[model samples]
Target: MLVPLTRQKFNQLIPLIATGPQYKYYWGKFPDFLQRLLISVVIAAVYVLVRLFAMPGFGPILFVLGVIGAFYWLWGPVFWASMRNAKCRRYKYSGFFRGRVLDWWITDELIGKQETVDNKGDLVIVENREKRINLEVGDETGFTAQLRAPLRVEHKVIARGQKVEMLVMSNRPDLSKIEEITDIYIPSRDLWVSDYPYLRRDYFPEVSRRLRDRPSERPRRRRPPEEQKGRRVEEWE
Candidate 1:
């Protein structure tokens, strides 16, 4: 069922959203505007020093520095403001529902069927039924990078009934603070249309095919004997 995300649920799942370490580091050290301003000032000073001593130039240097200072002053506050807005939006839209009425399950028997390799070139299987989604998260490089993660999933729509399709749209937790709604896919009516500008399906097909075709317990390819011996020697050395 489709429902609005409540504050209580937001508080509960906020930790599971897979926030990168950089978000925590920045969120903690500069929670206040004053600290951000001070840090910007320090950075601007360093830039000015480099310009004055290392790359002394014409009037353009000062002009560039001025523009940089302006950006520095606005960047931190703008970022925090966007973050606050995103949290509110996420609380407003987060929930559990299906993308369509096709009646799908995570395949309880094959949850957390990760493929790993051991030192002996043998495949190892670890069963974890507690995990919900089969997602591989990447490390965050910066604020822009962090925002891209949520944006990726912001374009998937949900359909509950025969003709009703609810578009799922929300705010990004970082920059690029645009409200985006995904395409609606109503399978019963055979209707599908995207409101978002860019809509492309590439990885979904390959992943779906793999999951549907093979058993989760399938073993991965083993490394050659020569490669295994080389790895062992390297480890010892």
Candidate 2:
């Protein structure tokens, strides 16, 4: 049965998932806070050295302070990653549902360029197009939910009048978020990133454990590997 996602739950999920102005979610770029953490490590080393030499008893305090600095710096990205995995899990599992894209619209809002790796492992650019897409999803139960997608053309598979398989929040079985636009159809890409909720049981879990768990979904050589042995492997369009 299709689980429902409530509007309220989606609201809470947003601030938790939108890691930064950078759209690394679609792009394979590391977490935004990663830079900050790297800087913190350097700062911590310098900071500890100064405090330890400047005062004896205060060494512990200085160390504590430095550790705190690292905590906050790492916290944001870690938290976001965890929550995103959680949602992804539900999306691939319990939240399994289906719906259709009633309509879609683009927004003028654009963030700076962010790097997102395509299935080809090429570093593709993901501009924050923030296409404001609204979809009306319905199931055999005659239940429907209005969903909005915050992703842009490059990051999403959504299109008007397209049938989609999606997942809802465990608690709220009516409203859904834009990320839940699982069964998306990108006309330009000509492939379904999400076709139905019947993905492998390990889909989300595999990703959570390792980013490289699944091979790139990008279309690879259609010909058998043996056939392409001597020539360049032609990519699927």
Collision count for each candidate, in order: 0, 10
lDDT of all predictions: 0.36, 0.46
Q: How far does residue 16 in candidate 2 sit from its true spot (Å)?
A: 13
For each candidate in turn, the TM-score is: 0.23, 0.40
| Candidate 2 error regions (>4 Å) | 1-46, 53-76, 83-94, 110-130, 150-161, 172-237
The sequence of per-residue lDDT tens digits that candidate 2 reaches over residues 1-237 is 233333343333333344442134333346545676676787778786787577677878787877876565655445555565456545421343444555555455575788889999999988865445455656445556664445444545555556554334432222222244443332333333421222232233322223224344432212334554556321111
Which candidate comes out best when scored by TM-score?
2
Total clashes, candidate 2? 10
Deviation of model 2 at 155, angstroms: 7.8
Predicted candidate 1 versus true structure: per-residue lDDT over 1-237, tens digit per residue: 222334453333233232333233234433455676777778777776666656445547666765677466455544553464354345344321123243222223333477789999999987755412111111121111001111223224322223323323334221122243333334344344332212122222332233335443322222445544534211000
Please report the candidate that would top lDDT against the real structure. 2
User: For model 1, what is the alpha-carbon lDDT of residue 16?
Assistant: 24
